[model samples]
Target: WFISYALDEYFYFGIFYGMILVFSFYNLIMFIAIRQKQYLYYVLYNLSVGFFEMSTDGIAYQYLWPNAPEWNQVAYAFALCATSIFALLFTRELLFVKAKAPRLNQLIIGVIVIRLIFFIYCYLFNQTLFSFKFIEAIPLSVAFFTGIYIYKNGYQPARFFVLGYSFLFAGFTLKFLIMLGISWLNFGVVSYYSLSFCFVLEMVFLSFAIGDKVRLLKLKKDKAQQKIIKQMAINAKLKDTVNQELETKVEERTREVYHKSLIIESKNQALEEANSLLQKQAEEISRMNVLLEQDNEELQTSVEKVSRDRVMNTEVDFEEFSKIYPDKESCYGFLAELKWSKGYHCRKCNNDHYFSGHILHSRRCSKCGYEESVTTYTIFHNTRIPINKAFYMIFLIYSSKGKISSHKLSELLSIRQSTCWTFGSRIKKVMDERKKTLKKTGKNGWS
Candidate 1:
């Protein structure tokens, strides 16, 4: 029965140590991958738990059971103290509460230091510093209350921390109860297994928390990218609208400028036409003046020749003849002859055969009884002024080249400025009407 129990003990120890070695390597790799201080703390915590489990297992069952080793009690006491410190550090790191309370950390450190000093003194003097059994359970109580405080504070990671510490505290509590003569299960086996199982579950929970944190970070990154893409799309649409509006404005301005250009071109064309008409009238007036000058010179020469012939009596008779005759009939006949160089035709009958009836200074055409006058279709028609006066008005208008002011023309013509202005306006209106009529006729293929 003793050998069987020894073998069972060895097998359990092997299993526990094997698990610790495997978990240690796993946590070490995780620590490297994560690189966060929290993960590092977990790695240290796991290592410490493994060390305590392996050491206490050896001391409690293998080294001190049946027959105690030489320094069994002293070694176990030192191991217990070390284990308490490790538990305090692990719980503090896991809960994230130690950073908020500096005093707690100082108190824990002070307790560990005092315990260490007492433990060393006891080992050297062979005299205990307060009883070993009495202080051995103190770390358990401290761990339990710490776990409760962490849980009450709503620390999420504290759940695993509290559970791991609870397993350890229960293990120690059972041992304490058993030492005080309490009859229960085997404390050694139960404590080791419970502590190991709790550690495994704690590691699993920590891995899940780290993964959750990573997933949340990724989600936040994706949301930021989506927001940026949405903003870029909105900016692109605004730019397109602004560009289109600018293009529309440019097109409108270009059209307005083109319209103004066309208006200017029309005005230029009208001015060119008026200038051409003035130039032609000027040339006609110059030719008419030249002809009048030649006729006047010829008359002066004829009179001088008659005076040189010494015909005083004939000169007097010629003067009396000029006075009596005045040659108004001859002038009228000459004008008629010039006007009807083409044979006269009766307008009503549309016939070339026509009779001329002399009535003093005028001639009447007798064919369908339609009377004809030499000046009827000419510029001299229906004028109350002398022919010379009418001719002078035409000459003045032609000489001024269409630039003469109406007031200036009235003064030159010895007519009221209002009458001159009215006549000039009427003439301009008639010219415009004729031009429009000619343009319409040309469009219709008429001469």
Candidate 2:
């Protein structure tokens, strides 16, 4: 019997230490992952409980059981009460109801303190304030209710707690039944196995629950990220549409401006041509006026010669008179001269002379009645200004050198500044036309 009991004690110690190591490792892993104060507290409490169970079992049953050693009983009782107090503290903190039900938690704390004090007093004074049966049963009942409360409240660790406590309660009940000779099995060893198995099961359940919670949290986070990505894609598409619309509007506006520019260019070309024609007419009129002035000077000289010859008592010089008149018929001789110079021969009369006008200063053809004024085909036709004024305007433009102010030109010409500016602009247009024509001719030559 002694050898069997010794073997049982050794086996129980091995199993108990193995369970302690496993729980310690599990607690360390949980602490690393969660880093919660409540989990640390639970780990400390479980370690204390493991220590109390191992020590009490070693002393009470293994060392002094059947002999009832005095010191062993005191040690056993102390370990038991300490383990109960730690368990109570750990449960209260786990529930996190210390704030909501402060008085209840404080009452439990008070009870543990009072129980500790009484246990110490009994150890020192050799008195017992409470029976062992009452002490053990009361704490067990409190543990059972606490486990049920945690489970009902949907605490994640509650399933482990409930399962573990249920196993412990059943083991204790079986031990009591054995003590009363109501069972044939060795309830003490069975209780140790039951408690260890339940602890391992509880740890497994706790690990699964924690893993599930973490996975759910990750899933929710991923869903939120996907939602944000979808919204961003929608925004990007909207931005692309807006940019395309803006580009289309820009292209439309550019086309409109191009059409308007073409219209403006056409109008500008028409105005430029009109100005060039006016400038050419003014230049021709100036040339014709200069020729008329020269002819008048020659006539005055001839008249003076005639007067001198008369004073000298000489007969009228017929040669000089004929030279002066030159057959008034040939006074318009220049009209035929200009037509013949053009190399035009009349087919109806078979001679260029037939196409020429016979009447003095007449532009009408003697043969065919075809007529044209000397200035008709020239640039001087239909001019409004006097020839001298046009010549003066051109001279002022060339003499001003650069960027001549219209106001200065108006003062010099004794004309309105508005009229001077108009004339100046018309002259610039003619100059531009000549430049454009020269450029076109140059390009044609190059081609």
Candidate 3:
């Protein structure tokens, strides 16, 4: 009988020690990988349980602290205290008790402090009481109750946490009953090692609880990212739709303005000359391409004519016109030539002889010393917009026969609608004043 019991005890220690080492090492590696405080606390909890088990089974006396037999009596009490403290800490982190149930979190902390005080009292005064490990039922019960309270309220992972603790709670209650002299319930080593079996189950279920929490967090992150992508797609589609509608409206407006321009051209000799020259020159360039088609002046002249037409035509977009008048100096050169087409009769003193003034393209009268800028009396005077954009606005308004709206001019010139309306109103007022002269002046009527 003694041989069989010794073999059974040795086998029980081997399996229990293996379970403790496996669970502790696994959780220790998990803690290192993820740096979660819960895994660290769980490792400490498992080690304390292992220490308490070794102390009770005389393994600590045989292998560790064999020379100090006096110290062995209260060592398991310290391990039990550590076990209670670390178990509560692990539960608090895994179940998120502080955020989920503030009152339950406080109770768990209070139980830890009480357990520590009780362990210290037993060590100092009554060392014999350390053998009654059934007293740990209070702290274990408190941890188990916290899991249930947190799970009751919508915390999903707490369901697994509560299930794991339920087994440990049952094992502890069974041990208490057997200790209270229920002799029939004792089933040899199976009943003796019940807590070890419960530890294995608890370890597996807690891991499941951790995995479930991670899955829920990933779902929330993916959903937020999906919402952002969906919103960006909607914004891009709306922008494309608005651009298409604007392009369609601009095409229809250009067709209407082209017919009006043709009517004006038919009544003017210079317009007919320029139009015929363009068609005749375009044909000359196409004929040159019939042989060799090398780069030359005739092709260059055709490109220059098209560019020159874009400068005067209302149908031209601002980007095309900008090639001809790229900056303020180029715009000023055109303004100076047109303002002094007839003569430079200064407004202050109508003297014709002049010298270059301080400002670019400005002319100073020699006799009276009166200086006049290119934009002195022009519609572009004191305008807030760039001179090049103002020049394009005039070209668009004149070519459209003053029929184009300020909104259309704003889009074409890339200027503010209010500024376009103000400048366009000035141009239209001048056109209204010179209506009769424009009728007789032909294509040069604008200058």
**What's the TM-score of each model vs. the native?**
0.43, 0.42, 0.55
List candidate 1 segments past 4 Å from native: 59-82, 98-155, 185-447
Candidate 2 residue 311 Cα shift, in angstroms, is 99
Q: Is candidate 1 or candidate 3 better by TM-score?
A: 3
Flag clash pairs in model 2.
none
- Whole-model lDDT for model 3 versus the true structure? 0.80
Per-residue lDDT for 333-357 in model 1, tens only?
5467877788777667766665665
Ranking by lDDT: 3, 1, 2
Top TM-score: which candidate number?
3
Model 2: how large is the Cα RMSD against the reference?
Answer: 44.6
Backbone N/Cα/C clashes per model: 0, 0, 0
- Kindly provide the TM-score of model 1 when superposed on the true structure, using C-alpha atoms: 0.43
Which regions of candidate 2 are displaced past 4 Å? 59-157, 173-188, 191-447
RMSD of each: 48.0, 44.6, 23.8
Sorted by TM-score (best first), the order is 3, 1, 2
Better of 1 and 3 by lDDT: 3
The prediction achieving the highest lDDT against the true structure is: 3
